[model samples]
Target: MNREAIDILVHSAWKLLEAKDYLGARELYTQGLKLDPFDATLWNYRSNAHMKLQHPELAFTDAARGLQLLDDKLATTNLSPEDRNFSVFMKIDLLFRCLLAAENLDICQTALKYIDRLLTNSHLLSNEARQTILSKQKSLKLKIKTKRHAFARASDSLRLNLNDVLNLGTMRITKYPWNEFEPFNSENDIETELKEINIMLEPIAPKLLVVRM
Candidate 1:
């Protein structure tokens, strides 16, 4: 296909994507890719469509390929500051989504590095975008920390007493509400009651394992 035809297909893909017709977008992207396999923009759009379709692994693969192609193109050409900043942000955003879906902490950390670079170099990003990046970075850091803490706690529990660990796990698996509490009238009240119970019982619940140990 000619460049003009490729452009038309790309534009059609964008229109379909804007309309939230991801499958239609993907079809257009596939046609574009057939004509221009190394078109980074088409690949990126295809990745977005795949993500919307809940195909995270395929999305990540296409995003990575697009970024690689873009990087090569950038190395040879001098892009304007605004264009460079936008491209970097898009790459980082794609990586962040892919990492989150994969639960890959290392990839998330690498994406944060790009976010920091964008924040340092670009003044064009809106305050909301900056805040959102900061929020995502903070959330990923907390998730990694929480996983590490849970692993450490489990290890310590097992080392301290095997029977206690087993009983604790069993209790967690078996415990169920017996309907002693009234039906929650509102979401807020339900959340408040659950939070209170969690806070109050968390420390005392471990003691139950002592008897089993």
Candidate 2:
């Protein structure tokens, strides 16, 4: 397709997206992408369409490509500060979403790198937007740390439980002193013994308070 045709497709796609017809917009974006594979703006638009269509993976890939193209253009020192700042902001925002969608530690790390660069020019961003980004960064960091700590605690609990079971087995073996004794004898006998033991230990267990609704 020619430039005019690509422009027409992009315009129609934007209209469809505004109308919340994601499938139609996606089709138009796909067509436009076919005609202009290297157009960064078209890729960004396509990514928005994909996101509205609940295709996170495709959206992330397109966003990354758009950011790459933008980065290439902004690499020259001739660009105005405003233009460079805008490009950097867009890259940071896109990288943040891509990191969230991908849920990879490396992606999150990369996103933070861009975010830090953006924050260095925080004066350029609106107060609300800057605060929002800072909040998100704080929340993500907290979540990662919380998950790591919880996983460590769970691992410790599992190890303790395993050790307790092993110690119990050893005690039982010492009490029987022979494999031929058949300590359990049957499932019903084992259940009965367990019930008795639980009853004996019931008083020591933590009590639950009843609450009236």
Candidate 3:
């Protein structure tokens, strides 16, 4: 491995990352990877750059690769205590990045897997970060449950709306779309007439309300 050159690239990329120049950092990391693709640190940081750029799939892939590399190192090679601790730290961070990317991809199950794996190392985390992961696990469980329930009822003609989703976690049936109307085209303002009628009814409808007396 061309360690010296890779170190320079990694250092330069870190500076770019700190400056929020994600693309520049990505480019530098890519160059370093070309020299030494096995550098788990480079892959992890590049995964972070991919995430910052909103490329979830790329971020997840790179993070997975980084974790695999780190795992291999920890399994096969004996290292100093300091080195082992740092590698474990990197492994946990890669899992975190993978979890975030999976969530962005709407693969909640994958996110849960990564979160579960992370919690096993909870002792290494600060209280705040550990709490955040626990909260995320709770959310992922609810999300998975909601998704499964919704999917079971989904059909070719049935469309999902915000209320349909919001209703899943609660027992009470929600009044979705208090008024159901035929779908109206919005580009030409097809609902303008109905909107006007509704506005006109605003005054009369209240008058129709019965009093307890």
- The candidate that achieves the highest TM-score relative to the unseen native structure: 3
The better-scoring model by TM-score among 1 and 2 is 2
TM-score for each candidate, following the candidate numbering: 0.59, 0.61, 0.71
State the lDDT at 139 in candidate 1: 79
Residue 212 miss distance in model 2 (angstroms): 60
lDDT of 2 by residue, 76-99 (tens): 889899987777767766655554
**How would you order the candidates by lDDT, starting with the best?**
3, 2, 1
What are the runs in model 1 whose C-alpha is more than 4 Å off? 77-114, 120-122, 157-213
Worst 10 residues of 3 by lDDT: 171-180
- What lDDT would candidate 2 get against the real structure? 0.61
* lDDT scores of the candidates, listed in order: 0.61, 0.61, 0.75
List, residue by residue over 15-69, the lDDT tens digit for candidate 1: 8888999999998887877777666677778877888898765565666666666
In candidate 1, the residue pairs with backbone N, CA or C atoms under 3 Å apart (3 or more residues apart, or in different chains) clash, namely none
Q: Write the per-residue lDDT of candidate 3 for residues 1-213, one digit (tens) a residue.
A: 489999889899989999999999999988887777778898899889999999887787778878878988999666989999999999999999989988888778778888989999999999999999999999989988887777757742566564455444231111111112312233334345544555466576722212111
- Find the number of clashing residue pairs for candidate 2: 0
Q: Where does candidate 3 stray beyond 4 Å?
A: 155-213
TM-score of 3: 0.71
In terms of lDDT, which candidate is stronger, 1 or 3? 3
Cα deviation of 158, candidate 2, in Å: 8.8
